[model samples]
Target: MQVSREEILHIADLADLNIEEEKIDKYLLNLQDILNFANIVNKQDVSNLEITIGSNEAKNVFRKDEVKVFENTESLLENAPKKEQNMFKIPKVIN
Candidate 1:
């Protein structure tokens, strides 16, 4: 899992990153650590693991929709800046 300076520069170029000269060593160490961790993960055995397409406890919690007229219609229209025919009047948007 040894990452070279050339590989680091290539990765930086691919990611469009401008790594400072002093920070190149830091990037090289971090990239090598990531590669080492990936190698460790690739060595794991998961052949008997079940393939889950969906959750076991998943269920719809939606309530049934109901429509009812408001009791205080005049009070709702009182806060509107412009009212016309008991509806809020807004500026015309389309020409």
Candidate 2:
């Protein structure tokens, strides 16, 4: 599960990354560590375990949709630096 110097160089070339000669060893070590972790995960014993989507037993906790009008219009618009027709106005981005 170890990453080689050549593999690191190849990856850099594929990604169009300009990895310095000094940093090649560091990159190789980090890549090797990631592969080692993957190897460890692959060796896990999950034969007796069930394939579960989630661990939580609770169902959806969503509330009913409701629309309510704001009572205090003046208070809500008071903080706006640029207000236009009861709405906050922003500078036009696209032509």
Candidate 3:
């Protein structure tokens, strides 16, 4: 579509912009190109493509939680700086 210089200036004025006199022609041509590309995209045929809500159709993909006993409890707590009841004894955080 052809964009006029007056229309460009009017849009700029509405947007509270102060466009330079020399750049109006450049802006007019750029706006016209963008509108022409949009028209081309609007006229495309997409009847055979599947409609997607997002990039993929993945849902909740998590493994079931199960408790298991460790064989070597002494080795796991060997490097603990403080151990009281067969476990790593950390400083009490909450009052």
Candidate 4:
């Protein structure tokens, strides 16, 4: 699966990329290396390998949820630059 320079230029054109003249060879080599790797992987035999979804036996594992109350209020807001009504305040983000 040899990639030509013209095909690389065509791909750049389709992607709307401004590839410099000197960088064309670099792009061509990188693309060719990727295609070569893909071809190598495609030629491998994986018929004996088992199809497994996960490495662990656990499925949908979740911890118990509980509310925790902090006794320190002044210490929590001590480092905040802008604190309002016992909370960190920020400028309106959604326009």
**Model 4 ranges with Cα > 4 A deviation:** 44-95
- Per-residue CA lDDT of candidate 3, range 19-60, in tens? 999998888888988898889756779778777777877576
TM-score on alpha carbons, each prediction: 0.44, 0.43, 0.44, 0.44
Query: Can you list the residue pairs that collide in candidate 4?
Result: none
What would the per-residue lDDT of candidate 4 be over residues 9-60, giving only the tens digit for each residue? Answer: 8989999997999999999999999998889766879789876798887479
3 or 4: which has the higher lDDT? 4
Off by over 4 Å in 1: 46-95
lDDT of 1 by residue, 43-75 (tens): 878778876667776666897698877999899
Each model's lDDT comes to 0.87, 0.85, 0.86, 0.89
The candidate that achieves the highest lDDT relative to the unseen native structure: 4
Cα lDDT for residue 21, candidate 2: 92
Question: How much does candidate 4 score in TM-score?
Answer: 0.44
Return whichever of 1 and 3 wins on TM-score.
1
Q: Assess candidate 4 and give its lDDT.
A: 0.89
Q: Which pairs in model 2 have colliding backbones?
A: none
Off by over 4 Å in 2: 44-95
RMSD to true structure for each model, in Å: 11.7, 8.4, 16.1, 8.5
Q: After superposition, how far is residue 5 of candidate 2 from its true place, in Å?
A: 0.6
